[model samples]
Target: MRERFDVVPLAALFLGAASFLMPFAALKENRVVDGLLLNGFQLAGPLYGTVAVLTAFGVLTGVFLMKNGSRRRLLYAAAGVVCFWLTAALLVRAGMMLTGGAAPRVSPAIGFWGLPAASYVLIDHSKKGRWRMWILLVVMLLPAALLLAGGRGEAISVFREWSARKGRFFDELIVHIRLFGMAVISAAVLGIPLGILASRDKRIGEPVTAFVDAVQTIPSMALFGLLMAPLAALSRTFPLLRAMGIRGIGAAPALIALTLYALLPIVRNTVAGLASVPLSAIDAGLGLGMSQRQLFYRVEWPMALPHVLTGLRTASVQAVGNTAVAALIGAGGLGIMIFQGLGQAAPDLILLGVIPLILIAVAVDRSWGFMIRRWVSPGLDMKGLSA
Candidate 1:
């Protein structure tokens, strides 16, 4: 019997190979003037041999996927991708080491960046279960851990930026976290009640959704600009609020904008989850002398929780991405590094911000997904939502 194989992962694997052969990073001086573009072949570090080995394994895994149809094969492919990812990081460190510690700026080029997408495609194609959560976490963290253990070259090069500002990097990182957390909390607080109200009353539902939907349509910068007038005026009118850090161009407006953007998903998911609850269950609860509150808390909330959680996951991811925009308004997140990089024409500085943002978003999205799979509903098909 001939086995049917998935073509996408196979294609991605070859693409990853093509990327590997290409220039992985550019060696620069002082993060401004580009020095030399270097491919993986140029820097033969201690792990250079391992990089070649993993690259071969990735190629073979793709071939295996093409010839065989099994979840096990896909898992192996994912493992290969993970190994390849670590290889790229080590390759960067190797390149830096080859530069002989001139404090060269190592800017990751196309190949270094593109590997993650290929890895993601491979992993997403694989059939996952509750047991795979640990594997997934390990896979996610392994690259960073290995890079750390691989050599000091990687750490020193990356942390050079951190060293420039002393403790400021940590301070900005905390600000980013606070911005994300506050927006999500506020959106949830408002969205859940609005969702419940909407579900309870069609009359109220249409307008509330329309308003949030409208809010969603406004561009981030425009929304930030729009908030400035009122917020600034309010700050001027109330010194107490101004003293409390409720400024127009800082965290306050940024938080408000992100919260508004977040409301739609949370509200939509809450309504969707609640609406998905079975009428029979509700009637049974009613028959059991359950009050309206009891009926919702007992029957509706539980069933709807999984969906609501899914929405929160979506909102949370969106919030992370959007918080970067908040940096434009002086809210001060990782986006500060990004914009400064752009202004200075420094790609390495840009990556310093972007890499962390991507990691944070992915971490939140995956953790929420894992929780949903484990605690919400093991049987729920997450593919549609994820896709």
Candidate 2:
């Protein structure tokens, strides 16, 4: 019989193995200039032979086993993960060795970045549920843990950058978090009521959603500019507001703009989720003689809750990304670092800001997923929420 194999994991493994031939990193004398590429052999140093052998063996063996329909898929995934971790470790070691006493910078290149993504595919394809989550977590953390323990490599470079501006980094990070947090909370508070009104009245819903959709079209920078004058006048007119740290140029306009940006998704999703509730459920609640308010609170809202949470999740991720743009107006978040990096042409500095933003977005999405799974009523089928 002809053998069959899983395509995705196999592709991921092949891609990862191919990355070994690409440049793993670059050594730079300064942030702005082009640096020299360090291939797998250079990156792995004394471990070059070991890394090369494993990359070839793992890819070949995994593909063969998968083709033969063996039950050892997880074993292949585990091996891929080990290869990935060792590759990262060696790259870090090389970076440290190069930058040990010199001021030269060691920044990760495409191969270094691509390897982890490919490894994630391997891990994800092989496992299910908490096992996948746990293994992924371990695979991700082990490289960092080893880097920290060794005190070397690109990890050291990022840490050095962090140390140089540690105070500013944390402060700006806090501001960035607060800005998006306030925006999302305000959007939810204002959005849910508007959503409820819209769900109950077509007249109200049409105008409200249209207004939100219109607001969403305005460029963030332009929105900030639009709010600047009005807020400035307000702050000047009301000394109390100025004293309360409500500034037109800084966080105030940024917050307002982001809040408006967050509204459309939340309100639309809320309306959609509520409207999607079963008519049979509504009639049954009425047949039981519940008041309109009682029926909504006890029935519709419970059923609509998951969809609403999904909306919140969408808004939150959007807000986190938009917060980066808010830094242009001096709102002071990771965007500040990002822009500074751009100005200086420092990729590592940019990563310092961007990596955290990506992580935050992922965390928000995962947390919401977990909550929906745990808190939403099992009787309600929410598979249609995105509809």
Candidate 3:
């Protein structure tokens, strides 16, 4: 048979190989100061040279040479991921071991960034990643998760930043989740009804559509600014509101603005999903003694659900990012660490905040995709979804 190269594994090889070519980590005296670059091979030469070199060869043979759909191909790819994982963990441990008496901290450098990036692509490469990849991926990640939970990543700069602020960090993280949840839920509550009305009545649809579309055009900062005054005034006017923390520059105004920004996507998708429902299905339901409401609930809604989930998925991810901006108005979340890191010129601190946001967004998006695939109405066309 002729030889063929898969883009996914090739991409993984490029990233992982490229990562080691440059500095793998940094040694710093303090969080904000200039640091010395350390090559993985130099810092932990025996470990890096052996594992990385062996894995590079393993990836080439196992992923590149093996036939597509072969179990061995997948096993090799998963092994490559696990090898890289051990290289990172053990290398960091060795590096930290060196710093015991000297006391200078170790931080990730530019090249260090590629390890996880390469692993992610490798994850995608493992048999289209539909089953979430070879068992090796799970085995490797389980301990990593546990270590992170146990706060054992002391060698990495971001982990150090996390160690310093973990108490407040958890608190801010919960608040951030709340902000994202409230925004998406509020938008869905109002947007879905408006979408239903819009589908049934063009008159109401056009105006509501225009209004939500206009809301999207406004910059988030400006929207937050606009809501603050009215909220502040309301709090002042109503002692009840003030006691409930409905101030202009806090969660109240931030939630209102985030909800407004989230509305357009939800409303637009709701309209699209409903309209996409087949008339034949509705007619069939009605002929079977179903009333209009029964038809909507039993026939139309089931068909439209996948699209509705898509819109909510979009809104959910968007809310995660926008919630970061809400921190500017004292609506606390991970953004507090980000802005504070910026003010102090601490890159690791910024990363401590930014990384979580990225993870949260990816988690939400993937969850929605999982829902559409597994839990949605069987009436949905798989072809449309794949497209």
RMSD of each: 3.6, 2.9, 2.9
* Predicted structure 1: lDDT: 0.76
For model 2 the TM-score comes to 0.90
Clashes of 3: 0
lDDT of each: 0.76, 0.79, 0.78
Model 3 C-alpha lDDT per residue in residues 290-365, reported as the tens digit of each score: 9998888888887878778888889999999999999999999988999999999888888888999999998898
Model 3 residue pairs with clashes: none
lDDT by residue for model 2 over 166-239, one digit each (tens)? 99999998998999999999999999999999999999999999999999999998999899899999999999
What is the alpha-carbon lDDT for the whole of candidate 3?
A: 0.78
TM-score per prediction, in order, is 0.85, 0.90, 0.90
In model 2, what are the clashing residue pairs, if there are any?
none
Best by lDDT: 2
What TM value does model 1 have? 0.85
Per-model tally of clashing residue pairs: 0, 0, 0
Q: What is the lDDT of residue 133 in candidate 3?
A: 51
